[model samples]
Target: MLSIILLAVALSIDACIVAFSYSLTLNKNLIKNAFIFSFSSAFFQAFMPIVGFFIMYYFGLKFIELAKKIDHFIVFFIFLFLGIKIIKDAFKNETIQIEKNLSFKIVFSLSVATSLDALAAGVLIFSSKLDILDCIFIIFVITFVLCFMSFCIAKSIKLNIKLLQIISAIIIILIGFKILIEHTIKHI
Candidate 1:
C-alpha cells in the first residue's frame, strides 16, 4: 500500500507541475476551475494505467519486458521534450501569458499529455504484482490531492511565474534523467 502510494505520487508529479503552471494565471474562477482541472488530471491518471496494464497484460510476459525497455526510453524523451518546451517559454522575450482556456478539449489534451508517464507506469505496477484496482484508486486520490495542492500553493506564492515554470522544468528534466539512469542501471 505504501509503495503504491509512492508510485502514485511519482506518477502524479507531472500533473502537479502542470497544475502549478496554470495556477499562476488563474486569478478568477480559481475554485471552480481547480476542481475541473483536478478531475481531468485524476481521470486520465487513473484511466491510463488501466489501459496500459490491460494492453501489456494481454500481450504476454515477454512483451512486458520489451515494453519496459521501450517505456523508459519513451518516458525519458517525453519528459525531456516537455521540460525543454517549458524552459523555452520561460526564456521568451514576451511576457508569459497564461491561456486560461478551460475548454474541455484543451483540458483533456493537457490531462492526456501529462498522464503519459502514468500509462508507462502501469506496466511497472503490473510487474510489481500489485493489485490494479487498488493502485488505480490510490493514484486517483493522490493525484487529485497533489494537483489541487500545487494549484493552491502556486497561487499563494508571489514569485515570478516564469521562474516557477523554469524550476518546474528543471524538476521534470531531472525526473526524466532519473528514470533513464535507474532503468539503464537495472538492465546492467
Candidate 2:
C-alpha cells in the first residue's frame, strides 16, 4: 500500500505540471474545467495499469518486457513533438486562444497528452507484481488532488498567460528529454 501510494505520487508529478499549465490558459469556470481535466487524467492513469496488469497476467511476461522497452521512447517522442508543436503554435501570428468554457474534445486531448507517462508506468507496475487495484486507486486519488491544487494555485497567480504557455512547453520538453536519457542509460 505504501509502495503503491509512493508510485502514484511519483507518476502524478507530470500530471500536476500539465494541470498547472492548463490552469493558466483557463479564464472562466476554472475549477470546473480543472476538475474535469484532472478527473479524466487520473482515471486514465489508474485504468491503464489495471489494463496492463490484465494484459500481462493473461498474455505473457515477454510481451510486457517488450512493451516496457518501447514505452519510454514512445512517450518521450510524443511529448517532445507535442511540445515543439505547441511552441510553434504559440508563435503563429494568429494565436489560437482557448476559451474559458471546456469542451470534451479539448479535455480528452489534454488528458491523453498529460497522462501518457502514467500509461508507461502502468506497464512497469504490472511487471513488478504490485497490487494493481491499490496502485490504480492511489494514482487516481493523487493525481486528482494534485491537479485541483495546481488549478487553484494557477487561478491565484497573476502572471502572463503567454509566458506560462512557453514555460509549459519547456517543462514538457525537458520531461521528454529526461525520459529519453533515463531509458538510454538503462539500455546501455
Candidate 3:
C-alpha cells in the first residue's frame, strides 16, 4: 500500500514540474489557465496508465516491451523541441512574448510526454495481482494536487520576464536530458 502511494507520487512529479514551467510562461489569466492546464495534466497522467494497463491486459505485455524501447526517445524529442522553442522565443527580438495559445492539443502533448513513465509503470503494476484501480486513483489525486501546488508556487513569484522564460526553457531541456540519460542507462 505504501509502495503504491510512493509510486503515485513519483509519477505525478512530472506533472508538478511541467505545471511549474507553464506557470513561468503565463502572461494573463495566470491562475485560471494554470489550473486548467494542471487539471488536464492530471487527467492525462491518470489516463495514460489505464491505456497502458488495458493494452497490456487485453493484447499482451510484449507490445509494451516493444514500445518501451523508443519511449524515452519520443519523450526526449518532445521536451527538447518544447524547450528549444521556448528558449528561441525568449531570445527573439521581443525579449519574451507569452502567446495565449493554451490549446487542448498542446496540453495533451505535454501530458503525454510527461506521463510516459506512468504508462510503463502502470503496465508493470497491472501485470501483477495488485489493485490497478487503487493505483489509478492515487495517481490521479497526487498528480492533481502536486500540479496545482507547483503552478501556484510559480505564479506567486514575480520573476523577470526574460529570466522566467530562460529558466523555464532550461528546466524543460534539462528534464529531457535527464530522461534520455536515465533510459539509456537502464537500457545498457
Relative to the true structure, candidate 1 has a C-alpha RMSD (angstroms) of 3.7
> Which regions of candidate 1 deviate over 4 angstroms?
1-7, 21-29, 102-135
The per-model lDDT (C-alpha) reads 0.78, 0.73, 0.81
Q: Which is the leading candidate under TM-score? A: 3
Off by over 4 Å in 2: 94-98, 101-106, 113-131
Residue 71, candidate 2: Cα error in Å is: 1.6
> For model 1, how does the per-residue alpha-carbon lDDT over 1-188 read when each residue is reduced to its tens digit?
88888889988987897788656654567777788999899999999888778877888566656755766677677678767876886777687844454557646756876777686667877788888999999999999999989888877888877777778677777767877898799899
Which lDDT tens digits does candidate 2 get at residues 52-167?
77776688677666766776777687678756766775676566564576568656655765565565566777777776776887889998998889878977888776777677
Which ten residues in a row are the worst by lDDT in model 2?
A: 93-102
Per model, state how many residue pairs clash. 0, 0, 0
The candidate scoring highest on lDDT is 3
TM-score of each: 0.70, 0.81, 0.92
Q: Cα lDDT for residue 15, model 2?
A: 75
Candidates 1 and 2: which is better by lDDT? Answer: 1
Cα miss at 161, model 2 (Å)? 2.0
Ranking of candidates on TM-score, top first: 3, 2, 1
